[model samples]
Target: VGNDTEPYKTQKYYGQSAFPSSAQTLTVLYNDHFKPEITTSFETGFEIRMFKNRLTADATVYESVTKNQIIDIPMDFSTGYSGAVLNGGKVRNRGIELTLGGKIIDGDNFKWNATTNWSRNWNKVMELPEGIDGQQIIGTGGTASIIAKVGGTTSAIYGFGFVRSPEGQIVYDNAGLPAYPEEIQYIGDASPKWKAGLTNSFSIGNFTMNVTIDGQYGGIIYSQTHHKLSEQGKLNSNNMGRETGFIIGEGVVQNADGSYSPNTKQVKTADWYTRYYRRANIESNSFDASFGKLREISLQYNLPKRWLKNTGLQSLQFSIFGRDLATVSDFPIYDPETAALNGDTILPGIEMGQMPSPATYGFNLSLTL
Candidate 1:
C-alpha cells in the first residue's frame, strides 16, 4: 500500500472535539503532520560445535538503521501552540553477541556443565531535519535528561557538569567552590558497552545443582535518591568532614598567564557538600552501573526408583530455588537496573524514587504418574 499522510485524521474525534461546542473554549493544541517512521535491520551469525557436541560456541553481529524518526519539537508562543512533531531524523545501531557452552566434566555418577554469553552494542545519530541540529531532549528524569544529538551516542545522559579548564583542572568560582557548566553537557552513556552471564550445572546420580552469575559493565547511572539524601545530610560522604575545620578541594587553578597552580583555598565542610550535592552536576550524582550479581541458584533431587516403585507415581522431584541473592556494586540504594520511567521511552540511566528489586526464594515440587 502507498504511504498515507494524516493517518490519524479519522481519530481526531476522541479528544476535545468529542465534547459539545458549549462545553469548552480551548480545543486541539496543534495539528498532526507526522508520518510513520521506518527501521531497517540486518543480522548474521554463526554457531560451531566440537568434541561430540560437548563444547559449542556461537556469535552474532547486527546493525539497524532508523529513518524518518519522529520527535516532538517545541514551538514558540507566537504560533499559539505548545508543540508540533515532524519526522526527519536518522540513527544507526550495531551490536555483537557471543555464547559458549561446554561439559567440563562428564561421567555416569557425576557431571558438570558450564555456559557463558556476552554482548556489546554501539549507536549514533546520523541526520536530522533541516534547520535543526538534531538535538532533542526526550525526557527529564531525576537530575539528568535523555538526549539525542547528531554524531553522539543514542539517548545519552545530558546534564550539568563541573566546569573544567583546558588543562582539565577543576574551575572554581569566587566563593572557592566548584562552578557548573554553562549548559547541559554529555554526562554519561546510559547504555552498556558490554555485558555477560555465566551458568554452571552439576549432577550426581539423581541430585542436581545449578548456579548463575551475571554482570554489566561500562555504563553510568544517575541516582536521584543518593543526591537528595546527601543534600539532606544523611549520607556518610556528607558527614565525613562535618567535625573537621574545612574540606580542601583537589585540583589546580589556572593563572592569568595560563600557568596552573595548586588550589590552597578551603571551603566550609557543610557548604562544600551542599553545593556539590545540590547543584554541582550529573557527574557528581552519577555512579558506575557496572555490577555483578549472584543471579540464581537451585538444588533438586529425584526420589530413588526403588522407593517409588510401589507407589502409583512414576516420578517425584523436589527443588529449592533462589534469585538475586547478592550484588556487588558501588551504586548505593536502589538497583541500577531500576528505571524511573520505562516503556517506549528510550532514555535510560536516570533513576528516581524507584523501589529496589526484591529477592525471591521458594520450593518447587513435581510428581508424575
Candidate 2:
C-alpha cells in the first residue's frame, strides 16, 4: 500500500583489513498514488435437467471490466530509478460457457454417463493510463513480446517479420535471405479462441472405467525451440541441399525497374539453414498452437459386498490411470501447449526450450472398515 525498500548493506574493505558498511537501495520505486485494482462484473447462467434427470445442461455468459490494474512502468534514467509500480490500465473480458451431461445407459449393474464442456472468451484492452498511448509491453520472451493494445486482445504478440512486396509475397535480398522491417510488428494473439473437453464414464457390475479428452483451438506461438533445432540441423527438413552443397531460396526479388521477379539465387547449404532459421526470424518459427490431447484414461474395480463381509471390511477399491497419454496436432515440436518461463512468470505464445509434457501412469487403492 505504501512502498517497497530493501535493507541492503555492503562492506568496503580498507588496505589494512578495516571494513566499512554502506547501505544500498533497489531500483524499483513505489508510487504513493497507486490504488488497489477494481473489477466490475455481471454473470448469468442456468442449469436444468430434462427427461427425468437423464440429460443435464448448464450455460453461462459473463462480462468483466477491470480498472486500475497494478503494473510496473519503466522510468527515465535521469530519475535514478528503473521503474515504478503504478495503477495503470483497464481490460474487458466477455465469455460464454456450456456444459452438457447425459446418462446414456441406465440399467441394473450397468451404467454409462458422458459429459462435454465448451467455453470461449474475448479479451480486450479498453484503455491505458494517461501518458501511455498506442500499446504497452506486458511481457517479453526473447525476440518477441506480449502487449496490451487498445481494441486488441490482451495477449497480443509483437515481433519482427519478413518484408513483403505489394502483392503480399516475401521479398528476398540479393544474398537470398529474407528481409525484415526495422521495427517490430503485430504477430498474433496468444489467447485461444475456444476450449472444449469431453469425459465418459462407465460402470458394469463391480468394474468402472473413465476416459477424458481436451483440446484448444486457434492461437499462435513463437517457438524458439523449432528455430534452435533447425539452425543446428537437428530437424529433418534441414537436410535439404546438404548433399548438393547449395539450396535455392523461394521468394520474389525487387528488380531494377521497381518491379518483382522470382528469386533464382542459390545460397550455400549451411548459410541457408543458419539464416533462415535464425533466432530473430520469428515468421519461420511461429506455429499454430492448436491441439487435442488424450488427457486421461482409468479403470477401477471394487470388492463386492459379499466378498468384503468375510474380511470384516466395509469397502475396497483399486484403480489405475494414465495422464497426458497422447496429442493430435500440426505442431512441429514436442508439445503445442507451451509457454515461455521467466523467473516465476509463464507467458503464453512464446516458447523458449520448453520441456516436453509428462505422461504419468499410476494406480490407486482404497479401503474402509
Error of 2 at 242 (Å): 2.3
Candidate 2 per-residue lDDT over residues 108-179, each given as its tens digit:
989999999999999989898776757788888889889888898779988888788999888888898776
Once all C-alphas are superposed, what RMSD does model 2 give against the true structure? 4.4
Candidates in order have lDDT scores of: 0.79, 0.85
How much does candidate 2 score in TM-score?
Answer: 0.92
What lDDT score goes with residue 349 in model 1? Answer: 86
Question: What C-alpha RMSD separates each model from the true structure?
Answer: 3.5, 4.4
**TM of each candidate vs. truth:** 0.87, 0.92
Q: List the residue pairs that clash in candidate 2.
A: none
Per-residue alpha-carbon lDDT of model 1 for 253-310, expressed as tens digits? Answer: 6678877677777988777777777643687899888889999999999999789877
| lDDT value for model 1 | 0.79
